[model samples]
Target: MPEQSKRLIQLLENEGPMSIKRASAKLQVSERSIRNYMRQANAKSTQILTDHSKIWVQERKPASLDFSRALPQNYRERSSYIIKKKIIEKEEVDLFDLSETLYVSYSTLKNDIAKMNQEFHAFQVHFRLKKDKLVIFGEERQIRKLISHVLAQETATHIIDMETLLNNYDKNLVHIIQQEIEQIVVHPALSKNDLAKMNLILHLVIISTRCQENGGCANDALALVFRTEKEKQWFGQLIDHLQTRLAITYAKEDLEQIQVLLAGNLNFRASEPSFEMDQKNIRFTSQILDLLEKRFHVDLNREEVKELFLRHLHNLNIRAQTGGFIKNPMKESIRQISPTIYEMAIVMAVEYKKYFQVLLPEDEIAFFAIHISSWIDQSNALNQKLKTLLVCPAYLNFQSDLLQTLSTRFADELYIPHVASSEQSGMDDGYDLVVSTIPLSTVSSQKVISLSPIWTPYTQQALSEKILKIKERKKGEMIRNHFFEYFQEPFFSVVRKTSKEALLHQMCARFNEKEIVASDFEKSVLEREKACSTAFGGFAIPHPLVSSARETKVSVALCPEGVLWNNDQKVYAVFLLAINEVDKRVFLNVYEPLVSLLSDEEFMTRLSAQTDFHAFSSLLIHKIK
Candidate 1:
């Protein structure tokens, strides 16, 4: 079966039924092609069923996929196959044999090897062909790290477990390792999530397989040290269990690397400081907090928050030093949930790279973001609560009951300081929300919610929805007030078609000519774009990796013909933001709402069709209102 058909089946199984038109749009195929894919997929197993104009999965019966016979079809898959053969499977392959198996030309196979070498540069590993036979050479530690990365990329769309493990590893070996991990005792502060535990089992299997095949990973540079006796005891027991169960012995360096991996994966949250933390960790934590304050205007220097941060930093430092980092499975979800917190985490990562000269992987960055988000949540809970006014008419003294329900439900979200009758509601217009039993004739400008005197599930749900809308409206209003200030007429353009680099260059040149941005602004923006595309929901938000603009300004480009932002994605609109240091907070204030507004695909499609800035901006402001 074609790869697209398998992907279509996976999509339907994961994301429920979708109309043919919607599926075609999402898969970047024609309606006819979608139907063809459905037919091909259904012919294999009859799992895909179509009802009217929609397709869905009836059941996901496992298919006996013979990976050995199925040759890799793309550069990514071919590279993964080659790496797995050399590293995990410990097999050497002749170039001619591989070319014949992959159905590629000899020269093409050599070119692929060159590309793999280039990609492997960062991991300090490389592939070399000795007399047309492929062999991999690198530090054992680096080799394992590369294997972890390759495994992650291969199984990105699926869960990591026995079923997935069987695709690449020996089933009996995997089960043996899993059984041992299940028998071992977990630490108190370690994560007990089944997924994390499964990941540990997978890595241990990788380590044992490699060591058993070749030899122990012995490096004199790594010192085996444990901070506390609990950690030491834990490490000793784990190694002893693995050695006894597997009939193998591990080197000190392998033990050290294992300890680092444990620290990276299992260290979820900090408890009381087991021993006095190091001064280097203390200094790094203080610097990060100060940097967060300076860049985002966020002060996370409270004693409790600082202490937790310091403890996490201790583990982070260990990973940096030992060159063993765990991959985060929830990295994408965390990034999508709170982009603002993730952005703050990126700032910390940049500082980490500069201070430690070790680049933290995206997984490690996501883990650090967990800590920062918790601290921010704590600070927001204590300091920021919506001031609410409850207005219920005097009817059997039921106003008290209604207020009590609200206070209990939204204790952390709302602060109800005043209770007034409908007639007395016009006296105060200062609260963020006005909840009333009776309709208000006046106070037209206030955010008013009229509900039943008796609080029911319907009323509670309505109030919850209203509170969310109120928050978004206030956030939208903040950006709307200064919308014109950031988006100026001179910075607006209507382009029939353009490339990302061309558009960025034109805008950055204009800004540079007007002395609005530094000369290196375009370079920074391009670097950031290459690292991660800013395109989202048919629009792109391109910004610099670092803020050093003379003045903060937003440039808008309406590409009615659609400019390609990334592979398989064309952006109809581009929002290029050049932010100054002093105006960083302003950027944060508007970034979320701006993304939210542009994320409306239908609205953006219509708005981008407008030829003039006046029409586009007007439609945008009206929508925000």
Candidate 2:
């Protein structure tokens, strides 16, 4: 076998899978050359790979180690990978010898080892002595995980490379593994991107392959307590397939972990026979929908949302029972784009803790956010869209990008009727609102709202609010002036970090400085929150239990990071009410409509995207109206 062929095989065994483009780049060859090498690996080195040997056999296989290029530049760059491979191979190394190889002093190598010892120990791996030479020990399974994590960190792409995980860490079965997994899962609702499914499969391969190699027996660490009769039958069939196909006997724990991965990954499409839903899952799903309806006033009990949640909850509960995890590729995207949904996910975390007695990880929370975001999009689709006109500068700008973005985002909410350039300034187009980049004094038969060029979160909020206001005013219902009077924009702020009490104190201090509330306002608010959670759909409606403020005012804060509201809920948005005795009715009138709109899944999605105070206030008034 050629050196490239051996390298290709080794890479596949250790990493998992890679695209032809990536493999060519990693190997410093053309994609065509890589393919030829892959073919050679199968034909010539078949017996060598069967042994699962990590050593380079020069005669049997001419693919000897090319040390100079393979070894990374420095200890800082190569230490982890080198150490991991050495440990996996059970190769002992003396400090003095490693110092010579790495071109560093013995003391420096000692210090690096000491630092690494502390770090690897966290993952249940230990660097200790074996036959008077430093080597790695501890749980072999965890050691493999630590190695996988390190290699994954090296790649910049989202793809998880499968390194011969199924081939005893030696052969390529990327296509076969993917196909087998799809057949096994057979869930229709698998993520549209399929990255989530791949992630699930990658984790399973890592754990299962390592466990099997170690002759790992059944461990109850992550086994499910409850399973439908059908799930049990299905799980058994799947395990048998994996064992027979991969040529490894899976222990009870190995089978259980695979089940946990699949269960928590609710990417399953609906079943023909209707899944035997868990009783606990049904209760939890009902509670979640009930909470959404009570808090957001949106009925997500539709066939799709209900079915999706049940599928997700099936795994969520199992994860809740076993503390298993499923990586969400869209975790960061959901956090950045739909913070409100992310907070709702945190709320699920809190709620899950209440019933299941275990907290779901953020990735799991993001899985929940995926469902909520989808529901919001689908719900919004059924609503009436607003008509608007875009007014850009005389010169061509990035207006088309802005239009496409806004249209895509607020698909159901906004419809751009015409694109009017400021130089021409035609106002008779009869649009619901004129969103002008430049200030336009006159726009007959339409509302004119000047926006910034970048279409920042602030501008998006402003545009959304303008459309809502037009609709609200047509009802002869004045929700704007009262809101503008009570909710001070200067008092409003966007917080990245802060605790619940600390945030409350800060908001109360602002009100005190402005002479809007009494000294005990923050205390009373905390007490109220303790009495009952103020958070609903990621927004907390915390206020004094009794009316005792100087006036009826709302002090608001948006924390995208989400503050822990109590032991259960985390809130991203805060609405602090300070209502006086005379304005008691004002609280009921404003609070009811205010919380209802803010709690609305669609509205929260919109609000979380806004980046400015004007945009924030504009949306508030529109929703209130």
Candidate 3:
């Protein structure tokens, strides 16, 4: 049930049938509207009345004639009764004190009690004033049923009416629809008309879901399907647009089938699969082709699907061996885009009869691998090693050539190369470090190192010294088991020799059982394996984003056992990063150097050999320099 309807029902169940004025105040609606709704409800219940005489004879009618007349006059009195019930059922409340809170004159409250007693007697219910409190003694089941009926009446008359559904809740539904439309909108194969028609069909589906009844004919459904003349124009425009967008002709029968499926009273479960198939066979293929040609600027034909599939499959196989699976990542990306993307993909797959043939499992794996690889590569280029400028004599083009040589050697390690002319020297440009071809006349205050313009062994040795000095100054002090110390108390103790799942569970228990660590972190770490493999040379850095956890902390685990991570490598160190916030600049700066060091085979061999925590810390601190 809808939340509004459920809440209304709960309110009526607890408070009983109430006056139009009282009910409106409780529900925050106008009294006139509540009265009109009650009249309609009474009209509907007329046939259910057992005694004809009682229905027609005013004197014979029940004193509590309808729900609108049954509520208590003052809000305080009603509130007291509600609180009293909860405490009585659950075991405590002081009702005598509650009466004092209502602030009603004692005599006025007595008169109100007398009125309730006279009215409830007609329904075989008694209102007893016990110890200065009101309690209803009556048929429990019958009272509950009446309350449920009253709530249902209010929902049908107020909440689910045309104006409320269209103006209030429809915005959220329309947003979802718009997202779906964009997915198929720019397809190269689809004309403007095809996209418009698909949008119309979706709009109609939204209207149908909000309809009151499900057994209506297409004509009746269409009447409720659209509310404005603009909607009618959109519907007509959609049909015209589809005709021009699709190369394959859709017969009159196909148009009728669409109308009937959308407007007829079939349940969504029964209609959705068939609707998807029709879209795939006719709409999606044309749309995809249009998008590729127009938006992506790629010309694609039917024959290219096979080649694309093969290439994707090969990449996927290599990734699967390294990364665990691609299904979850693809699903996540698609879900993030919009709900419509998922719906559209499903429809296209079903209609084209390529639902099972496309090897989506592999395609998805390749997509995530490409995404993560590009992200890592860009991050490394932007922030890895410091940028340096080589200032040489203007006469010797050797300085410029040396810059190219360095760029080619460190292409994977640094950003694009920058060369500075002799005139530009001593300018204090934003370069992180400066390597001078000759000693400058001005005393160099900046990080300056002199170097020869040759790739000879002597020059290489001199360059390494300068590079080491820069690295030592840039990389700061290590954390020194600070993270471990943060969780040293009884509430956060060590979880030794535990499985990954067990450790995760223990962490959750220590913090709060309600805080759940995202399972996707494991999937993301595993999925990262497929593309080139996380085993970069020898070390692997496995981390997940802040959204994947409720808390953020880098859990560094050392394995002297040297567990095999991939076919070509073994992991001696693992950094389980639990990022949960955006202010992780420090963490981001450290990530590149850590990944780079891990990539070195010699570093991993030494890291695995180290036994003590001090030795491990010393090795890391030494490497930073």
Candidate 4:
């Protein structure tokens, strides 16, 4: 007997006197359908349903036509027949052999057999299995029609021209394409093309999964799609090219998504070239760089400034391709690097560029920079310390009152010191890096750092570190006489006395017989710049591209009379740096610390104060600690 009809008979017998409404709900079907099923049951067996809406059953009857239409099309009838045939013939068949002959997955065959047992109670068909085969004991004719009806009603969708599609690509190639597609789908920032690719890869992966489950041939045409030697070689080349250009690593998931897209018949269109730069964009970048140098004293050159703008554009292109509508993380990183008004203006440019093909408005960029400038000023104010005197002069009472007012208004990390007279030192013992109200002579020799009385607390904090840094930098600049022995020339020299161009040339001559090897010079300069800015505080350490010396050495030129660089701050000191292999070991370790010391104003002042190179070197080593 068919499992469905037999199960229906059993349900009616167990739940006696139940209405079709209750039965339909329990069976997950419409009440009308349940009633029709019950009517069909009544016609098939008089004992199956009682008169006047009550049902009674003797033994369960085999399933009827009413139960057949609801069964799944795949294997439903075949499973029922196999069980029934086995019982009738009293013969066993291997389940594995049956699965192979049926051209169905082992799991599907197993599920079908399991479902027969689960739903058999309703159909009144008893199921049993021996070592190799299943048995179904029930009336045959009724069950046969029921199973046939269900199989006919169940819907099935056909696979799209699998053979032809598989034939187009080798099985290995298909596998590769499937893998790439799967990766694209799982990525966070997916473009429309990425999504399409994902779907394609999924289609291929599903087919591979399906084929594997059915124990098919390992080397199918689909697998050859991504796996062919020529295809793999091309894929490797493409990956290398993209990585080199984009500075991005493709994840395994990305590869999977690509494979899926290709397998599912998708394509990725290349982006069109863009060349035009809007005037607003160019002006906006120029203005920001101008403000950075003018307002914050950051000495960024024209090319360096241009590179910053280019980085933002690159970020925008990447985000656009990824279907991202938000500002890129690069903007935030730049803000963290230097929170100047100019940086904020660049951020605005990045945001507005997405909306218009042309450049953004100049006023908008200026407005952002202005607002940022105001915010930075206010912040700096909050970080400043106020100068206070405790001396009782003729206007002591008035001065005290004024000091109180100043303390309330602008004092942060404020200092109040006692003074005997106008000439007396008013240094606070408990303050951090004290400044006195009296003249420099009146101050005690207690290593008290000096700040310009005109300078704000923000400037004090910034300059205090700057000056101290300069003194420490002197240690690294100390001349090593050993270099002269190896190179048969002074370890360092000053060329044009004023021009950075002259300094670079002299440094190059020390390394190469020619003053400059254009290619090597450019490459070295770029590498040095990338490592860190050569500009330490107001001093620029411009040197040769190569370290041709035998020993690590530095030639220092003290321009106590500062030279003009294109920017605002005068260049005070230039260190001609030459490092042999041994010197590099020490220099690399100490370079950052030395750079940091240049930020201390006191150290820079002390270093600048020294007349002799030995005195400068002594002060430098002392300050480095």
TM-score of each: 0.37, 0.25, 0.28, 0.22
Model 1, runs deviating above 4 Å: 1-385, 392-408, 421-425, 437-442, 452-455, 546-550, 580-589
Model 2 stretches astray by more than 4 angstroms? 1-476
Report lDDT per candidate.
Answer: 0.67, 0.58, 0.41, 0.43
lDDT of model 3, residue 360: 35
User: Which predicted model would earn the best lDDT?
Assistant: 1
lDDT of 3: 0.41
Residues 413-493, model 1: lDDT tens digits? 676656786556354476788888876777554478888988789998998988888778776887787787678889999
Order the candidates by TM-score, highest first.
1, 3, 2, 4
For the record, the alpha-carbon RMSD of candidate 3 to the native fold, in angstroms, is: 25.7
Q: After aligning candidate 2 to the native by TM-score, how far in Å is the CA of 554 from where it should be?
A: 0.7
Candidate 4: global Cα-lDDT? 0.43
Give model 1's TM-score versus the native structure: 0.37
Across residues 1-625, which tens digit of lDDT does each residue of candidate 4 receive? 3344565666654433344555666678786776666666666765455332233453322112112323324754566445533532223545776666556666777666665544333234556556756655666543442332222221110111223234433455454544443443332212323323333433343334333344443222222235223334545554454333333444443344333333222211111112245566567666655644343332332431242243334434454565543322122222322222333354445445533433333333433443333333322322223333333232534343333332332233333433333444444443333333334564444423443334466645654564354334333443232223222334333233466555555555554542212336534754675576576667777645575343344556566766554456566666656554324543554556656666687777667656765576667666655
